[model samples]
Target: MTSSSRALLFLLACICWVPVTAGAGERPARIVIDPGHGGVKEGAKGPGALREKEVALQIAHRLRSRLEAAGGEVYLTRERDALVSLTERVEMTNDHGADLFISIHANSMPTPRMRARTEGVETYFLSASASGEAALAVADRENSEAPMSRAARGDSTLALILDDLVRTEAHADSSRLAYAIHPRLVARTRAADRGVQQAPFFVLSGVECPAVLVEVGYISHPEEGLKLGRADYQEKLAEAISEGVLAFLKDTRRRDAARPAQVAGSQTP
Candidate 1:
């Protein structure tokens, strides 16, 4: 098939996956979006002077508008070029009782050679560390600013997973959320698929709701970086991500409705 043919197919698929809205009696889902970095902490910058922080915030706004239109209560961690701590971000997500939380960021490479050679999309859920060196490196960069992120020991991953299970059932749903969002991103953007991964991302450490972090694309790659800076391309990214979240919510609502409701004082079984 031709490149244009494939692009057309993706656009049609996006249109088909119309976002499901809340019914008359159903409460709208709450979503919290965190744009990676801001203020002096501008995230990765690359070709065309594309800055991760700027792109992330722009995408967040687009996503918020899309989700709200689809009957969701959307909240952004930071509305402008301001810095917000990981704790603050998670606090907002939990306080809002968000059904889902998404942190948006752009990836970067350490060297010029690697920058030119690498570019793709990677979606991640909280994990101590997995997917080997690349994921670990990505985690390290994202976690660099989190004061205690570096102190975690190797075995701490398992411990954290167990602890998270007790804290919130969202831990289990997180991977499902990651898988849903990642494939849609790759399909719509036709970007290289780096596959779903997991790492001990400090920002996700405190989230009390289902959460996933998206490394939308490598800002360091010349071609992709220039595209990332474009408003039209950013809108496509937002639209694709919105589709994924809505699909996942649709499934969640179905499962919720299927479960037997508890009586006035009886236990759920």
Candidate 2:
């Protein structure tokens, strides 16, 4: 072959031999972290008046840092102690097209006496009815936003329909996500494992992707409340949560890779 032709053919061969990396065109996974309650809504109050909002935001910031370091894009619904509506939080998550949505909060019991008895980490996914009485109570507290309308608070037919659709589309993934993170959170903090449950948390509803709300610990408990206020403990919680998220994402990617590609014009009943 002529020198010029040989050179051209070699270049073409190299081009054809180039391999596409996994996730070549995929954008970094986007995660939306909603720190529960702020501004006038101090949420639950613990010993020494440690507000749930403050603790949630602190943990969220730490979680964001950890997730970012691990190559995920993260956004917080409210960076400051401002009142962000539940609708606004969901809108932010949907607008970002997040791969995962996590709402963070600290748990509190109805009475100081109950607080003393209860201490643990629990995660929740959206559902029409709460898993049990405890879950229902938590949902009621978390869903109590001042700006929410009476209709929003009530069990309207439309709301039920929407909830059903959300559950149908995201329930399995949401459950997996809750299970994935809850164990890590408990192990890292050496806190009690309250276990994962389903509840109708307003902040978690209407999210486009897998969504979960985590009660990292019971701030109402004297011992647990004090531990939650520590920077080292917060760091441990953040690290564990981040690790769990990474593991879930990796597993999802693997599952997707294993699935057969859909042929054009294919239909399923």
Candidate 3:
């Protein structure tokens, strides 16, 4: 072939050689939001009878609105004052093939005195062991509804070890999601930054995708409790969470796009 013809042919060949990623035109990510506690299972109680279940549901509703506006397909485990099992929550998330799971709750200390001293937001992902006393305590309180028998707990430990590879990746993604959300939550609410943590939260276990449990604030704290009861504050919390979710999803999409594709080689005829 002439030099000019050969160059043109090579360019066409190169264009044909490019690999196509399977999910290049994937739809917007799906997300599951779990509002902690409901019905008879009211979560922590604050002064003026402000219940965690009620606050969590409100936040979840607001978050769903924001996420939907950002082009995410959002699902909430519970939309009202109704009890939902932890297993059911996990199943819902997996069934939807959600990209992320967020469990929302208001925190509380053991005693009124302790609650007064503690005020802030902390995010957590599943782990066999908690990051610290506070994380363990939070996990314990959250797990109370779905208490695992000693045998079940043992089985869960084994499952964690047996599925190490899957769990490790999920854990890493969960941590990244937590970090992405926690900072914005703290900034928007102007709450103390309790930082991200790891804990054996039953609600977060067995999720197929990155999952996190967020403690928005201490409901037992006199001042923070009042804030948690306010509709305006709840809206702010929802906005921050939505921002974080969009940020994480954007990063995930970028990483997926940068991944190397499997190129199919042509055979000599």
Residues 216-269, candidate 2, lDDT per residue (tens digit)?
899999999998888999999898888788778877777778999999889676
Please give, for residues 1-269, the per-residue lDDT of candidate 3 as tens digits.
79999999988654322221124465667889999999999999998879999999999999998877656678999888997888888889999998889999999987767977999888888877779987877888898877674245785674565357344677788988998899999899999998889887877877888999999999999999999999999999998998787777767767867998856675455
Q: Score each candidate by Cα lDDT.
A: 0.85, 0.84, 0.84
Ranking by lDDT: 1, 2, 3
| CA deviation > 4 Å runs, candidate 2 | 1-22, 146-153, 156-159
Alpha-carbon deviation at 99 in model 3, angstroms: 0.7
Q: Give TM-scores for every candidate, taking all chains together and pairing residue i with residue i.
A: 0.87, 0.87, 0.85
Give model 2's TM-score versus the native structure.
Answer: 0.87
Q: Candidate 3 — which pairs collide? A: none
